[model samples]
Target: MQAQILNLMRELQRALGLTYPFISHDLAVVYYISSRVAVMYLGRICELAETAALVERPRHPYARLLLDTIPDLEMSGRDRAPVAGEVPSPIDPPPVCAFHPRCPHADARCRSERPELRPDGGAEVACHAVEEGRLP
Candidate 1:
């Protein structure tokens, strides 16, 4: 099974461009096969950046939580905060920032509206906290 998967990956690499869109929720696979990564939540892209950069310094809250869950020797020494609540249904996402419901940094404005994917530093984030410069 592993050999077949590897063979397929090699074939794909040869056939596809250097930068191809490999969509999957498996971070390990993504990290192994792609140079850049885009983290999405509730059908919306929460963050996009270089794989290492995004994993090391996640900009969006969801991205941060997702990266925090990745177990690594270096990261194992650090404490991880739990991601609160279940993911909301994509068919009925919140008005503003679909992640606001479970976001620890969410505020009043978050529930009332959805945030846009605005350029921040090197990636785009769709959180009111990030839009308002409230997220650290």
Candidate 2:
């Protein structure tokens, strides 16, 4: 049923030359349906790029973590670390980078100043660490 629906949507998109602001936590499905992708955290876009580029080389820590959640058939024995820490309250979210609490590379600046989306490689990423080349 899901496959049929996705196929129908794809056909309609091709036939009508339509564009969609597709939103989903299911990365695999998003990759299949979207030409571009946006990764958001606390209602803010953390990363944005062409779907294939973003999936192949995510610049933001959150984006990387999200993609890592997908099960890989070839990496059967690899350890998968779940996104840690509870999501902060959306009503009164933390200041600065919303993902700082859970981000492994976060520093004092991340806790104090919000980062704006900036070009990082082929994608736009909103991360202080990425901006400073702290992340490889």
Candidate 3:
């Protein structure tokens, strides 16, 4: 039923030349329905990019973690370590980057200064680690 609905939406999109702000937690569904993707953490856009590019090479730490949650059938045996810490409350989100608590690459700057969206390769990412070239 989900597949049928997605297919129908696609058909309508093409027939009517409509653009939809397709927001979904299902990465596969988002990839199928969206040309661009904006990854959010605590109500802030952490990264935005072409769907294919973001999937292929995620720039932000949170973006990478989100993509890692997707099951990769081809690499079923690979061991994946969960990101550390917990998501801060949205009502009282952390001062700096929302993902700092869980980010493996987070540093002092990430804890103190909020990052702004800046172009990095194919994506615009809001991450101190990405800005400092600390993350690959």
Best by TM-score: 3
Task: Write the residue-wise lDDT of candidate 2 on 30-106 in tens digits.
Answer: 98999999899999999999999998888898988888878787876855556777788999988799998788898
Candidates' lDDT values, in order? 0.79, 0.88, 0.89
Please state every model's RMSD to the true fold in angstroms. 2.3, 1.6, 1.4
Better of 2 and 3 by lDDT: 3
Better candidate by TM-score, 1 or 2: 2
RMSD of 2: 1.6
User: What is candidate 1's lDDT per residue for 1-136, written digit by digit as tens?
Assistant: 9558856886777888444677887888888777788788878888888888887788888998887777776644776777786677888887677887688998788878877788888877777787878876
lDDT of 1 at 79: 66
- Would you estimate the TM-scores of all the predictions? 0.83, 0.92, 0.93
Error of 2 at 39 (Å): 0.5
Candidate 1's displacement at residue 122, Å, is 1.6
Note the residue pairs that clash in candidate 1: 96-113, 96-114, 97-114
lDDT of 2 at 107: 96
Cα misplacement distance, residue 131 of candidate 3 (Å)? 1.0
